[model samples]
Target: MTSTALTDDMALRIGLAARALPDTSPARLLAVLADCIGLPPNAEKLDTLSIKQLRSGASGELADCDHSVLKTALAYLNGTASTESMPPPVPQSPLINASGSDPEGTIRVAIASNNGDLLDGHFGSCERFLVYQVSADQFRLIDCREIDDRQAEDDKNSYRAGLIADCQLLYVVSIGGPAAAKVVKRDIHPIKIPDGGAAPALIGELQQIIGAKTPPWLAKIMGQPAESRVRFKARALEE
Candidate 1:
């Protein structure tokens, strides 16, 4: 089948499916398609392709692929994946720490997310911000901020930054330079996780850092003692 036979929409779907699969290239995915359901994969072929067939055909390309990832890829290929079904439900009510108290050692963080508590959204395009109150030992989902149509107007970067201005750290799959600048201007550190994963898992990693040698920047955010901050900073500089 000629490349031209695949429409732009079909090509886009293939690209997205390829991205879903670990270490898969579009060319390799196309090869798998050819193996699974003959040449020139079209909407009909993709829509009709079975998961068993896909898994069988991907033996070489996705030998170590996670089952959920493979399923997501196939869903994308069949055009059955909907962004609406991806995200996890938010808390029924806001659970902010309203007693005017800190949890000994805690800082607020915002995670850019589109799917079910996954840190999988770019700063500019994520559907919502999952705000959490976290300490070295525990965390709680305090708020869920949605990016509505109203916020789409005028300096979107500034607006998005302002939405989570109270957060000390922001986690995202990606962020543009200008957006990062805006976040930093608001005294929020923007952290980019190129391959996003579960927010809780990422937060666990942060907790490890906090429990261990907390970085100077993090220490400052947690309002640690000046001596502790200086010690960490000196060690970091020495390293």
Candidate 2:
């Protein structure tokens, strides 16, 4: 088989894995895999996949594939590739608080909801604020809001700053393109929330795994914590 054919086959397998996951983006999938493999945040380099390598089945460890097509597939999956060519560096800050009293330790998150309904229906009711606490046993919920509202203007900047600001992290619920663009422009890490069912559950599970708290609003909507379900696997794209 030619390198292109091998890549195509691998990509097909990975794509199939992704399709099994509902409301998951390739970027998010890649991020999950990267985290699992302990790869660096800036290691996504899939766009460089060549036709020669795709035809022959990947030999040895899948590291090359991991470094190339998988990374590219992730960028394509997350919808962040067009605006910025490279994946943003992972924020060097604590995603949660150690002490609720320490202002510096608080995980200041900006929940951007595209419409009031999604905010109201899915995120508003969850008791997810506890996930940000310093102690694993304790939890609390912070404020949640719509990005376009009157009060949100100032908060938006604050939220953007928090993503890169020392000890803060940003959480995005259902907002899209323009909003994502604004956040990314600030060099903040923006996590897109998946839709209902297993996706939300999977997110919650990952949050726990990462030792970060889920938003109180998200917890409430999810009702019950779901298992870890990876929607896609990295594969070299066909030439």
Candidate 3:
């Protein structure tokens, strides 16, 4: 092997050996090995000794040197080596509401509305729903879109079955009875909002309700007692 490769290999070997022994100094071990094999300027110089000299064993002091120094240095080196090379363990973040009686799983909430501005009003004439995952202090919006006639039907049935399969909570905000009826069979709790109110205002109002008397599904998803008031300023919808 080239000198660089040999040095790397030696370092890796020393590191591994130190880890295995847990009480050895890898430097000392390398120093002892270098001394016994007629390599370098002894234990003191082992740290800076080149791998080329170590592999060649061409140093002149190997014949007259005492073996006891090599042995003792090797032992001491093995013991101390581990401290320098070991990686620190990664720390984990604590889960929110870990002690709650709810099922050990994630909570999802779906908000269906007639407001087109929620999705930048892309589907101008269509209604939309925003699905979100509730956390201890915040809610993460996951999916938002307008569901067409066919898609609405499919989603109503499919969402119910899927949620039932996964045992997830389903919350639907609908404009009227027809759309609400589509998912009513799923036993989903429907929250009604005025078509005239802005999305942020509606959300703020709903948050207030949840904070005062949280619904069973919301309670599990939120995973924390709500303290702050939900507030927002109104914004005019674009034509």
RMSD per model, one decimal: 8.8, 19.0, 25.3
Q: Write the per-residue lDDT of candidate 3 for residues 1-239, one digit (tens) a residue.
A: 32323344346645543322212345644554656443422335445444333333434322222232223223333343322322212222323465643333344545443333231111112234555544334444555543553443544444333332222343332223443454455555555432223444444445564544455455544454333112111111111
What order do you get sorting by TM-score, best first? 1, 3, 2
Estimate every model's Cα lDDT from 0 to 1.
0.78, 0.34, 0.38
Best by lDDT: 1
Candidate 3, superposed: residue stretches over 4 Å from native: 1-107, 113-125, 150-178, 211-239
The sequence of per-residue lDDT tens digits that candidate 1 reaches over residues 79-150 is: 887524475656543344568665668888899876788886667666789998888888778888888636
Estimate TM-scores for all models.
0.64, 0.28, 0.32
Q: Alpha-carbon error at 147 in model 2, in Å?
A: 5.6
Clashes of each: 2, 24, 12
Indicate the residue-level lDDT of 149 in model 2: 24
Best by TM-score: 1
Error of 3 at 218 (Å): 6.1
Worst 10 residues of 3 by lDDT: 230-239
- List ranges where model 1 is wrong by over 4 Å: 1-84, 92-99, 234-239
